[model samples]
Target: MTAIAPALVPLLVTLPLLGAAIALIAGRHRRVQITVSVATLTVVCAIAATLLTVVDLGDQAIAVSVGGWPIPFGIVLYVDRLAALLVMVSSVVLLAVLLFSVGQGAVDNDDDTPVSIFHPSYLILAAGIFNAFIAGDLFNLYVGFEILLVASYVLITLGSTESRIRTGVVYIVVSLVSSILFLSAIAVIYGALGTVNIVQISQRMGDLDQDTQLVMHLLLLLAFAIKAAVFPLSFWLPDSYPTAPAPVTAVFAGLLTKVGVYAIIRTETELFLFNDVNVLLMVAAMATMIVGVLGAVAQAELKRILSFTLVSHIGYMLFGLAIATPAAIGATIYYMVHHIVVQTTLFLAVGLVERRAGSTSILRVKGLMKAAPLIAVLYFIPAVNLGGLPPFSGFIGKFALFDAAAEEGDPLMIALIVAGVVTSLLTLYALMRAWNLSFWREEDDSAETEARISYLGDAPAASVSTERRVIPRIMTSATVGMVGLTVALTVFAGPLYDICARIGGALLEPVTIGQLEQEHEQSTGGDDKGEER
Candidate 1:
């Protein structure tokens, strides 16, 4: 079992792609599509969970080389605790979102059903996400990004509606520019190091001049920052995401930017273990937090508001990464897990709100608390949780981050800590404001505005109970399931944090950073000795 564990790693990436092909072939039959998608994700999730347990318990990394080639020569899929844990959590989110989409598709009329293209593209997107999490080399990571981008382009503009087209154009342009920057960085790194393997690059990074190192670092970071939607570079996110379908927006808001954050974590802790740019990263983190929350405050739309807060909360992760201590990095990992679940849940719930209330824009929708109590509960739990209320995963994650930062005990770190607090308070204020307008306040005729609505079958509700019954069981159940996962994060904080702390401690070790390089050299040396014999 132990010897075969590493070989099982590729199944996480391959199963989803296989599922995508089958989903494409079966798209004409909704039942077939649903069955394939759910089964594929369930199996992938199990595989990811098993990988995480094996890696964590074994206290070792799993590296699978394709075509029987040794490290640096063939494509590799590597899974350490961090990568495996991320893949597992991501698979959970992917599964939940897929279920939510299936529910949405089920209730719609034949004419109202989502295009047949959604399933294949959605599964392909899952494959890309899984690939990125386990990618062992820089070039493979780039391939993962490309795969997802192509799928996202289709998902984002599913209807080919005027608004989606306009927004998709902007999104593709921004993504292309970022991709170009990433490709150029890869070229530079390859020119310098002769290999794009992450471990090899980390080992050889020291040999480069300071100027070359900084240039390579900044170029790669610029690309990732755009993808991560870091402030200044992040202006593209709020606009681009809101126009996509609810599930599309939910996954994009929750998972895509974090992939960029994941890259930044890898770059800082693993590749540049000895050399870091904490000051610059801290400044970016501060700005991302403050600016993102303020933007959330200004939005009158639920989706747009969540989108901004999504950007803001990313700063917390950056804060942990910038501190770079074991505790700080550990908190960062925990925070990522919290934020992904909560953010995705909020979006899923809001999607239901749009279905029942006739809009996501707070100015147009009203009285959901009375009209759809279940929907209200769905939104309220995540809303408060996201606002950093006590006894919730969000608060636990934030408190851990603040505690980690305080230990650093520097004035700059202290100031960022204060900013984090303010951001938390303001995030609560913004979410509550939207909640009050959308769910609590009575519908005022004078305040009403044009709403972008995509309600299924039913006309606008005449009473609270009527709207309550309108919600599909599957959609509500999926949202509730995600909310439960968020609760689990708080409930399981001890063991989860221990895992994150172990990962952080390992990342901080210089020897751990060069594990791949050391393995490569030892293997090569052994091969040469055998050849001589």
Candidate 2:
């Protein structure tokens, strides 16, 4: 099992890239494109699950050197428990979102997500995400980011609508700026330490002067902070996400920023384990939580409101990172998985709402309770779950995070706990408010609804009503599956969280290049002895 796991690491990335190529070539055959994309992700999902089991049972990480190159010189793909788990969850999300897009395309005749362009780009995006998760070095991670940027640019600008193109431009520019900063940091690190390999860099980072180390740390943090949509760096997200198609929006909200957060976790725990930036991160987390939810409360459109909440919930993850403890880190992982699924489910449900009604504006859409009870139910479950209601995965994750922080008993940790609770309440208010106005009230009561929410003050001007479309069964099925997965996070929280706790503990224990080399030798020597027998 140990021998085989390393070989599977590269396939996690290559299979998706191969599928994207095949999908692109089969442009004229929509069924062929769909089959290849679906099969690829399903297989990747299986591989990730296998790796997760292998790593967990063996209690060792698998690091593969691409092209058989030695450590610190070749491209390395590392699959520890965290990488494997995220890949598996991300693949599940990717597959579900693809099905949702397929249903939308069938119903709308590819008007929103041109099938030929969407399939290949979507697969490429999957490849990028998987690559980033497993990448064992900084340069490889940057390549993953670039791959995401290119594919997402195409996906976001699909249909070439003016609003999409405008948003895509802002997204592209922001992404490019972040990339440049990341690249610059890589250059500085490579120059200083003479290596960009993560384990090797971690081993060497302590050798640098305090000033140099601080500079390098902040550069990488700034780059990833922008990507994770951390406060003061998150302004672009709310404007950029809502303009994309539903599947595009859902996947972007679910997976993209989490990738950034994952990078930050790696940066903080693996690369600069001893860095004293926790205070700075805690302050940022507080601001991110409060400011982001404030933005959400001010929004009248469902998509924009959800986008702001997405940014708000990110602070919870940052708060965990700021705590810099193993338990906090473990809880952050759980919260990340929770937020990804629940947030994506909410967006997909809103997609259904948009199709059922002509608009997503709370003031404009009404009577969904009787008109579309299914959509109402679909929207309500994830809304409250995201709001951090009890027994839901969202609440479980937040409680775990708070419990971890309480162990520290620091004043800032306590303050962040308060901010997090307040943020959760505000998130619920924003989502349920939209729910009540959009679903419970009658169309004839629009005047009353407006009168009641008039304190929000004319923000509905940004919302535009379009012709109502038929809701597709497959889209709803995909969303229902996601919601079920969210519930499963709660039902099976015990075992799954144990795995995350172990991962968190393992993450803080730094591994050196020597350790990887030793493992490589042992595996090769064992294989040779078996061949002789």
Q: Top lDDT: which candidate number?
A: 2
* Model 1 regions lying over 4 Å from their true place: 110-115, 444-469, 510-514, 517-533
For model 1, give the RMSD to the true fold: 4.9
Candidate 1, residues 1-533, lDDT tens digits: the string is 55557667888888889988998887678888888889999998888888888879878777666665666678878888999999999999999988888777776642223737888888899899989988988999999999988998888888787878988988889999999999999999999999888887888999998888999988998999999999989988888888787788989888999899998888888778766789999999999999999888777678888989999999999899999999999889988988989999999999899889767777667878888888888888889998999998889888988998898798999999999999999999988877876788766534233232222112212111213225578888999999888888888989998999999998887433346634333323344233223
For model 1 the TM-score comes to: 0.92
Q: What TM-score would every model get versus the actual structure?
A: 0.92, 0.97
Best by TM-score: 2
The CA lDDT of each predicted structure is 0.83, 0.91
lDDT of 2: 0.91
